[model samples]
Target: MTTPQKIALVTGSHKGLGYAIARKLAQQAGIQVIVTSRKEQDGFTAQQRLATEGIQVDFHPLDVTNDSSVQQVTAWAQKTYGKVDILINNAGVNPTMQAEEASLLTMQLETMLSTLATNVAAVARITQAVLPLMQAQNYGRIVNVSTEMASLATIGSDYYPLAPSYRLSKIGLNGLTVLLAKELQGTNILVNAYSPGWMKTDMGGSDAPFTADEGAETAVYLATLPEHGAQGKFFAEMRKFGGPIALTW
Candidate 1:
């Protein structure tokens, strides 16, 4: 029997902004949203939580840093849903504190490496694994959840503060988004990097101005972009913020 709905794969969606994104997609887009997290319990809880809201959501265990885990999830997605029409690479990490304080000698190389593995490498790997299914249908939307802290323009202007490793990884992700978009420029796949404004999530901290719901708005918007919508652009919430900063290459 043909599935009754489209499928959206959202990573790190067990709670916070990821959960909000998945919930919105399921409720607004009428699609089967796959909620993924590293822990089974977390995923299950999120699945149950969304179900109570009268939304359709499924739990999947995915550790983006683990290739085997990524492969397993990709295989499951193909078998269960046939294809994933939308992918939100929302899984990321920011282990380091202030960028100024970080140094090659003082910084934890392991942590920095792990951060890049999740924030950048996994995104490319997962996208590659899922691209074929999307290609077959010639229709797809890929939204890479990036940060404004990754903006090179802002970093160079001295207006933006640095996060060193975290900023580097996000900038790399943005570059990947651009390259992927260019490669699939003529295809139905529209790839873009979305900077969900600073929100009060575990990563964004309680001092952030936006809530998870508010922060997820941009990602949800990009996930459902129309065929003619903008692609390969860096999008932030349409609100006033600090000036531009340059990213370290």
Candidate 2:
């Protein structure tokens, strides 16, 4: 029998790291890549871009913050692919204003709340919808795109001191990653937070070192991890960055 195709739903795949991850997965022989964005037009454009390179792809509009929109995408994945084998919770937002200082007091409540809603809450929402499907299959991989600044391991370091909203939200995201992995223990599904480092993107700015493709490498690797691969860790450059892979919250 032929190998089964793994169905993957990559959020915010219209551009940036998400786009690169989706493209890389689609290029693999037995992976059916589903690209999603908050905008339908952006989804189509991304789909067309991949198609021009001769990769077959599908698009679904997703607004991870909205329950209805999140459910809509999950329902489509269930209907179209039978099950979602991989989930990359990648769509995120940062403070729109330039960081004048690194202090939490300097950051506005609105900005932190906005960042938390998208960065932490939405990833949990989408994962909640997709987890059951993976549990039923007894196999899945969840790659939560996170940042190194979220590492409480280096909380006091001066150079990595700022972006309160983004950093704190990722800290919450990392917490979610740990909890989810614990809850899914003994199963094949592996949930982990991955830091792609700074890259050339809207949020990363042009001065960032890594290209979008280079940043997407680890997330793609985690998404395709084997049953025996590590789980429940903060990873960068394909290795565990801090502490143990599995631990309590």
Candidate 3:
């Protein structure tokens, strides 16, 4: 019997960067792409749009921040595909404002908690939920969509004035990536965090320098990496960075 094709789940892909990533993955033959969003309508719309382009895709509603929702999606994947070979933790939120005026206390208590819940905690939970399946197959690729703004090396330098909450969340995400990689050290599962650069998306904004297609490049590359490729590292535009470096947390 022929083996079934690989499966990929990309969250927040109803549009923008997530949409681009889903499209790219679908374009590859034999790859089943799951395009997900918080809303069923949005997910179906994205799936239909991709189908029009002759790309094989399915719609799944996933609200990364919600545990019940996460479980439902993972269960669906387990039942339908038996495993999720690639998981792109691309869902994130950035309610922006000037750093100085933003209440550090409030930011940490409210914004930071909420941001981490979705950007970091959700990623961790979902990865854990799917890890058993990967271990069974001895194959998995996890790409956490991170950002250059998360780089502590650039902080206090020329690139410091970006979205603080979003930055902190991704920084936490990078740390999680490292920890998971170390734990799964000898396994075939490869986990990495990537900064897609500033792109023109709802999150990246119109004035951003890169396009969604350009932004999705690193993510797609990392998703499709060979078993020998690097894991538990931070990457931006193909250049890997060292250590977790500090954030203002």
Tens-place lDDT per residue, model 2, 163-193, is: 8888889899999999998998889999988
lDDT: worst 10-residue window of model 1: 240-249
Q: Candidate 3 lDDT, tens digit per residue, 1-249?
A: 213888999989999999999999888767788999998998888888878877768888998878899899989998888888989989888766545315455455576678878888989888888888889899999989887777777755744455667778888998898899999898889998877777899877899877998778778888888877877877775423332321231
lDDT of each: 0.82, 0.85, 0.81
* RMSD vs true structure, all candidates: 3.4, 3.2, 3.8
Candidates ranked by TM-score: 2, 1, 3
Error of 3 at 12 (Å): 1.0
Question: Using lDDT as the measure, what is the rank order of every candidate, best first?
Answer: 2, 1, 3
For candidate 3, list the clashing residue pairs, or say none: none
Residue-level lDDT of model 1, residues 5-108, one tens digit each, is 77899999998889989988988755889999999999999999888878878878998878899889988998998888999999988865645325555666
Would you estimate the TM-scores of all the predictions?
A: 0.90, 0.92, 0.90
Clash counts per candidate, in order, are 10, 0, 0
lDDT of 1 at 75: 88
Please give the TM-score that candidate 1 achieves against the real structure: 0.90
